[model samples]
Target: MPVTPQPLGRRERNKQEKLDRITAAATELFAQYGVDDVTTQQIADKADIGTGTLFLYARNKGELLLLVQNAHYAEALERGRAEAETIPNVLGAVMAIVRPIVECNRVQVDNGRFYLREMVFGDPAEPHHGQALSIVARTEEAIAAALGRHGPIATGDAATTARIISAVMFVTMAASVNASLTTAAILQDIEAQVSLLARR
Candidate 1:
């Protein structure tokens, strides 16, 4: 038998509407002023919700930033994964899976850096933080698949190498020293390191 899902009730619809508004407001404000400069009150005002209501959705500005960046990071990962499928060489394939992520993180450098910090240091109990970690896990899985596909690497080695590559990419992006470097320069550095790592 074909089954139709039940529809959301009034309360659920209202909650979803508020969440959408909150996400949109946070995305715009965070993009304009960066995460550190934007206040929760400002987000609430823009979302047309009370501060308490905003808190109900996201407890603080960091959480709000997670809510905004998680979507973008997920999209970037998918784009990179798709691009990686077309490249044959191991290094080229790995970098294809990395380039969009680096580009996404550099969109607003400060926000990107803070988002990385939050992913590392934020409460795991938080839903958004968990989503961020899931994206990282998915990224590593994609890289490991690429490594395994292009060479005679063992499954365990591929997974371990992928973890190292992910760490390298994230640390390079989040490092204070690389904050001033252009995206191309950072990508070059990552490619160099990845080349050394990908060598069989």
Candidate 2:
């Protein structure tokens, strides 16, 4: 039998509304001022919610960042995956998957670096942190899929190579030495490394 899902009750609707407001507020504030400069109280004020109420949505600012950036990262991964589908060359396909992510991370350099820190160090038990980690895993999966499509690379090799590529991308993006580099420059560096790695 076909079944229709029930609509959200008032309580659920209110919670969704509050969450939307919180996300919008945090996104704007984080973009304006890097995550380090923004406070939880400021976020609460921007959201027009009490500090205590904001805590219910996100335990801390790191989690709140995870909340905000996770969506953008997920979108970037999707775009990369779609672009990878159209490119047949292995390196080109991999770069297609990587370019959008690098662009997304570089959107606000400090925020991007801090989000990487939070993803690495934040409590995995936290829901938002888990979501960020999930996006990363999905990114690797997309890369592995791209590799698998191109040549005789075994599934295991593809997965391992994807992990290496992911590590290179993250390190290159987060590295202090590369901090001042423009997105094109960073992409060029990553492409050089990926080209070396993609050679089978």
Candidate 3:
């Protein structure tokens, strides 16, 4: 007779156990030595697992970095989207979209900084380029829809406004990537810049 499979609960517990070990090791290693400097063998040793075991969790360090970055962005985006749904005004909605990204910098500035560096300016060999570009385009489209729904932007073209909004967000994200500024301070600066643009 064939061997019986494990229960779902047992399988899930096993998976979580493995993931916990991997994530914990990754955090410690990445914090101490940075992502690029940390090796698969080192991560496995840190986690008290074999190199083969580490491969079960992550294909490579680059993949691990993508996981860390995507997890944060997913959380921030969910928070921002939920908050935006609560506001009625278009500008408020726009601000809602920005607020989560800003809040990320407030709570995990170093994490945000690292992600921005790898994402916006990392090597062409990086794997998440398409995903990052998709995110940028999606965010701009969301803003454009909001603008078109509420009132005309000064440009009168929602698509153009969306592109402009995307550019502004990109620039702000780049600036804060390596700077010492707080999220609230960055948001204040953005508000001033946007106000000036509106007045023109």
Candidate 4:
């Protein structure tokens, strides 16, 4: 008879199990009830863990929400960067970045909704806003680089134009999420928006 492989250590296995449970419960609850309506106790119950155990992983609801958003956003950004590399045209690059985010917003609508709530109501003095702003700045830089190479935009105004385009993209994304617009619709609208910006 083949010997059975030893199982994972209790502590390591239990910790992984708890994390999985917590994430699964959070995804389901936030999806169904909206993040604002879901409670830590509810999440804990859904995970079949005590509320206290839940706190061992997350300090509070806000932190848990931030964690969830960060995970999703990181994945989306990676995909955006990959798509950006493939597109040769500046407009194509910008659209690649925006399209992934819109898709993520649609797929993770609840988490997207929760992120919007935090952006509105969370401590305005918090550093998360600064971090998010930095991301926008980096995106603007990428657009500027892509556009500066071709006869895309005036060299002197490339940065400004990129920033303007970034602002338009974000506002459009927010509007799309608010209106529950599909990603395809968002991309279609973006083509018109970018065309107007190209003339600037």
**Against the unseen true structure, what C-alpha lDDT does each candidate score?**
0.96, 0.95, 0.67, 0.71
TM-scores, one per candidate: 0.98, 0.98, 0.68, 0.69
Candidate 3's C-alpha runs over 4 A off are: 1-21, 27-42, 51-63, 123-129, 153-156, 176-178, 196-200
After TM-score superposition, the amount by which residue 125's alpha carbon in candidate 2 deviates from its true location, in angstroms, is 0.5
User: By the TM-score metric, which is better: model 3 or model 4?
Assistant: 4
Worst lDDT 10-window in candidate 3: 191-200
Model 1 residue pairs with clashes: none
Which residue pairs does candidate 3 place in steric collision?
none
Better of 2 and 3 by TM-score: 2
Name the regions of candidate 2 deviating beyond 4 angstroms.
none
Clashes of each: 0, 0, 0, 0
Candidate 2 lDDT by residue in tens digits, 117-162? 9999999999999999998899999999999999889999999999
Better of 1 and 3 by lDDT: 1
Task: Evaluate residue 171 in candidate 2 and report its C-alpha lDDT on the 0 to 100 scale.
Answer: 94
Question: Over the stretch 21-127, how does candidate 3's per-residue lDDT look in tens digits?
Answer: 88888877776777767788888887788888777766777666655556556677667767767777777777777777667644555555566665666554544
Best by lDDT: 1
lDDT of 1 by residue, 47-81 (tens): 99999999999899889999999999999999999
Candidate 4 deviates by what RMSD? 6.3
Candidate 1 achieves a global lDDT of 0.96
Model 1 Cα shift for residue 23 (angstroms): 0.6
